[model samples]
Target: MVLAYLLSVIFTQPVVTMEAEAIQPVALRPVANLKAKDTPNDAGQSIDLSWELSPDSARVKRYEVYRAESAKGPFEKIVEFLVPTTAYTDADTLLRNKKDYYYRVDVVGELESRASSEIAGPVQAKPEWFNTNRIPVLVFAVVYGLLLILYIEFAKRDREMFVRRIAGLDAIDEAVGRSTEMGKPILFSFGIGYLTDVATLAALSILRRVARRAAEYETRILVPNYDPIVMTAAQETVKQAFSEAGRPDLYQEGDITFLTADQFGYAAGVNGIMLREKPGTVFLQGVFYAEALILAETAHSVGAIQIAGTNMATQLPFFIAACDYTLIGEELFAASAYLDRDPQLLGSLKSEDIAKLITVGLIVVVSVVGTIGAVLTSVSGESGILRSLTEFFNSGFERLVSFLTTS
Candidate 1:
């Protein structure tokens, strides 16, 4: 409006003839040292532009920047309003890495506006493969990986890394011993869950150990499975266990039988076996449903020493009440490692333990710092050094946690 009004007023005060509408233009000093280059540390579709302030910048109202594909006059004004700063970043541009961009700055003064004599050009936006933002996460992954490998090596060397004894796991030998002394069969049941489940797999491993012990004691072992796959796997496990115990002759494929997959029907079948055969030791380890208490209570009434473990939390109280010993939650998952003490298992266990310790330590540190930050923020107001320190700590702590648990 200012430029248009000035032009109309000057041009309208005409003399005559050809010189009637001609008005002389006023001079304005353009910005100096204008430059543009591809932005650093980014997946580039952008460029950074900077320049020395105009000599007439104090007199000038503002400056406008323009961009063009070519070095000539057909430039588009990118800055709709005049910008006060001497520096700007032109991020919205054609992202084809092969294309070059040209930029010029125009200084607007009270009298007239002038374009910079030079334009920065030929700067190409390029993509970067390496993203620097995720360096913390990458660093954490490498460090945590190295730590796990180191602990695994330590375990392989037979170093005693103590894992607290689980009472439920420790009673397996006693249960097998009772079954042997009573001259009754030891019954192991992996409820409806298939061999694909981790809990079921752990149960199978524990069953293998129990079967071996039963073989050594010259005692019979029975595994009534719901899933046909688990039945087959159970037979193999029992066979392998007997073979390992030097009692291949004692292995019986029929003992690890395939019962119905129906939950209550399977429970009814197991209950009947408990009543008829009255196995001295009943092992229930797997996924179960409404039939959990039905089986556990029936076995309880039969005077069997039951050792039960399941991934299902809802059935835990029933097992704890009815069974002699119950492996709860993670104890069920840890059964195989607890029984065998394999270096690989122990290594994984210890590495996970270390990771847990680190996580807990971070949590504690973060909690205390965050609490202090909150209190200081409320009491002393948010503008102090204490608040700043807390803010800094909290941010760093959050980043650390996010990095650790990233994937």
Candidate 2:
């Protein structure tokens, strides 16, 4: 009798516990405080939605977002978040501008159990005329414009603007004089460039300077061009330079002639002139490619004083190694301002320098701040002072980036 009574108690207790466990409810909770609004600082046809997380977020398998033109009846699911998320931006093409929208968020739990938040409504997407977040960019642009204008005015007022001398340009007279003393011709090649090229245009300014000096010294200047249009322009430039130097009679149109438009063909023609004439000074300016080294070396073989200037970087090292003087990159562009010292050009050049200074200063400041913030974050551990310093630096870094990049 005792054994039967014990067995009945054990089996009945096990059954009761199992039934209670099966009946216990799954704790599912809906998201709350759902909000929807037009996205800021953007073109029309977008809306932003946000919500508080469900209390049973750990059990949530995913969150689904729905949109409707009206709050009542059918709503279509526009997007879903497989992981927990608090916010979403609906930039779908179907979202029309100025049309009202309603949004709802649903928390899906394990085993298909679902709960939904109250609907959020009456939001319309619209475009903004100006993005307020880009105020920093506008401010910087305005400041640069004002600086440019002010400098131009100062230059026009006859205020002496100090400009550093470019050695390549300053040697123009020396190169022409050397050819004059040696009683040999000056060879100038506009290596395979069209009149439409900016580098070719910049080279024209340097050509004018060389031509003027050559005219003053009564030395013959030969300009071999690759493009016929460029040949015409070069002829006019040299004529003007000679007229400016009061030596128009010395201007020779035949000296500035077009060679072939073919790349290597033009280079060979220039090389032939360098070899036959064995010029005292060779001015290699404008666009050049594989022929840069060939021309520079040929001029060197003729024992010519080579003054090379081009906007091409690939050919610069070859010229620098083979030629006596070389103008690197933007120095070729700045030739007009440096040689002519025109007020407008000087003002523009100086303003660009100031702009560059501002950019470099900002970059340095940001780099230092970011480095310090990272170091502080790693060492803060348990120290409240260090942690506060880390937060301060991090906040400043974020603000700087946002100010520069956002909107």
| Among all candidates shown, the one with the greatest lDDT | 2
lDDT for each residue of candidate 2 in 216-288, tens digit (9 for 90 to 100): 9999999988999999999999999999999999998989998899999988999999999989999998889
Cα lDDT, all candidates? 0.83, 0.91
| Candidate 2: stretches off by over 4 Å | 1-142, 192-196, 381-407
List ranges where model 1 is wrong by over 4 Å: 1-145, 380-382, 386-390, 393-407
lDDT of 1 at 251: 90
Q: State every prediction's TM-score relative to the real structure.
A: 0.61, 0.62
Total residue pair clashes for candidate 2: 0
Which is the leading candidate under TM-score? Answer: 2
lDDT tens string, model 1, 1-407? Answer: 99999998788656443463244444678888889888776878888889888776666777888888888857888883354677888888554564788888888765455656488886787777887667866776776788779988998898997888999889999999999999999999999898788889989888998999999999999888899999988999999999999999999888889889888889989999999999999999998888888989998888899999998989898899889899997888877778888887878777777776877887787677667666665666557787687677667667655764563
